[model samples]
Target: MSRIAKRFAETRASGRAALIPYVTAGDPAPDVTVPLLHDLVAAGADLLELGVPFSDPMADGPVIQLACERSLAHGTRLRDVLAMVREFRQTDSETPVVLMGYLNPVERMGAEVFASAAAEAGVDGVLMVDLPPEESDDLTGLLERAGIDPIFLVAPTTADARLSHVAAAARGFIYYVSLKGVTGAQSLDPAALGARLGAIRAITELPLGVGFGIRDAATAGAVARVADAVVVGSAIVRLAEQYPDAPERFRAAAAELAREMRTAMDAARADAAPAAV
Candidate 1:
């Protein structure tokens, strides 16, 4: 099985939702990314989503936008982010790493070239915010050939027809944006989200990962009850910004939050466990 599928299967067997943490590559400093990646996994992150800094991250909120700016200012390029993933694979090879970014960089590098490079770097998937499924054949075709997943996002406003289209094109898993706004917007309603997830479940059996408003343990646990994976991004990126000058402090903060969320989700899962016969 692919690394992503394997990890999700393992988490599901454990009766706990997967914790996927996201951070921008080269944030704070280019050299600190690999260590931070390792720290996240140590803290119980089942999968990693490393943002490839871009000039225009329209889908991202101010926090992630600033993170991209910091990374870009340090001369971090697409190749540098891939190199970070490669370096991260030296010690840890189990956790899946998904590259999250815009299509501009991939187009600049050419879809085939980028796919080959990402697969070589140990990247298991790619999630491009601006690339829709209808226009993603060039990239998705190459990614599938390289054994890398093309992960897509499904927003709350998505129609059922589009959901089917996305589900058909997507690999790894489908990221369900918990809210209609950009990332970091705090408007997640767990009850409503559960209902939406129920509807989505009727369409596809692919693992459904919910993201975009999950900020802490409580929120993560709530979403964990209904989703296959809970993705926490802006909250972790905020930690990097909070301790920009201190990379160690940033990692510590990020790890602590991830651990807390993991604990909460596991507890929630146990609470929802079926009674033994």
Candidate 2:
């Protein structure tokens, strides 16, 4: 099984939602990326989503946009992100890493070339924000051939007909944007989200991960009750923004937040579980 599938299966068996933390590659500094990845894993992350810095991250809010700018300021390229992943694989081979970003970098590198390079770098999945499932056949084929899962995002606004297209194209897991706005936007109602997730669950068997407004343990716990995975992004990346020059501090704070989310998610699941008869 793919690392992602295996991780999800393992987390499922444990009766806990997987904690997936998103951080931008080369944020704060390029050198910090690899070690920060390990720190997050140590903090109880089941999987990691490394953002590939891009010039235009339209779907992202100001926080991640600034993270992209900081990373790009260091001249961090897609190749550099891949190199970080390669270095990360030297010691840890079990945790899955998914590259998340825009399509411009992949198109610049050539989809086939990017796919091969990512696979060689030990990347297990790719989430290109702007690459809709309807237009992703060629690139998705290249990724699958390289043994990489082409992950896709489903929004609250997605129609049932369009969802079928996503279900047909997606692998790894389906990222359900918990809100209508960009990443980091607030106002996540878990009751409403649970209802939406129920609709999505009816359509696909792929693990569903909810993100966009999960900023704290409470939000993470709420999301965990309904999602197979709880994806936390902007809240963690905000640490890099706060400590631009201090990699150690960034690592510490980010890991602490992850740990809190992990603990809360596990507790939430246990509370929701049926009592022994």
Candidate 3:
């Protein structure tokens, strides 16, 4: 099984939602990326989403946009981000890493070349924010051939017909943007989110990962009750931005938050689980 599928299956067996933490590659500094990834996994992250810094991250709010700027300032190209993944794989090979970013970098590198490079770098998935399902066939085909899962996002405004189309094109897990706004916008309503997830469940069997507004343990725990995975991004990136010169401190803070989220998510799932007969 793919690392992503395997991780989800393992999480399902454990009766808990997977914790997926996101950070921009080369944020704060390029050297910090690999070690920060390991720290997050050590803190109980089931999967890691490394943002490939883009010039225009329209889907993200100010925090992640600044993170992209920080990473880009260090000349963290897509190839450099892939190299970080390769280095990360030297010691840890089990955790799945998903490259999250825009399509401009991939298009610049050429999709075929980018796919092969990503697969070689031990990347398990790719989530391009602007790549629509209808226009993703060629790139998705290349990714699948390279043993990489082409992940897609489904927003709250998405129609049922588009949901089906996205389901058909998507691999790995489908990211459900918890709010209508950009990432970091704090407008999540778990009760409403659960209802939306119920509707999405009727469409496809793929794991549904909810993100965008999940900022802390409480929010993560609430979403964990309904989502297959809970993705936390901006909150962590904010820390990176806060401690630009103190990489170790940034790593510790990020890991602590991830650990808290993991603990809360596990407790929530345990409480929600049906009692043994």
Model 1 per-residue lDDT tens digits across residues 1-277: 9999999999888787999999999998999899998988999999999999999999999999999999999999999999999999999999999999999998999889999999999999999999999999888999999999999999989999899999999999999999989999886899999899999999988899999989889999989988999999999999989998999999999999999999999888887777411
Model 3 over residues 1-277: C-alpha lDDT tens digits?
9999999999988888999999999999999999999999999999999999998999899999999999899999999999999999999999999999999999999999999999999999999999988889999999999999999999889999899999999999999999989999986999999999999999989899999999999999999999999999999999998888999999999999999999999998888887521
True-structure RMSD, every candidate: 1.2, 1.2, 1.1
Worst 10 residues of 2 by lDDT: 268-277
Q: Which pairs of residues collide in candidate 2? A: none
Q: Write the per-residue lDDT of candidate 2 for residues 1-277, one digit (tens) a residue.
A: 9999999999988898999999999998999999999999999999999999998899999999999999999999999999999999999999999999999999999999999999999999999999998789999999999999999999999999999889889999999999999999997999999999999989999999999999999999989999999999999999999998788999999999999999999999999887511
Please give the lDDT score at residue 183 for candidate 2.
94
lDDT of each: 0.94, 0.95, 0.95
- Each candidate's number of clashing pairs is 0, 0, 0
Please give the distance, in angstroms, between residue 1's alpha carbon in candidate 1 and its true position after superposition.
1.2
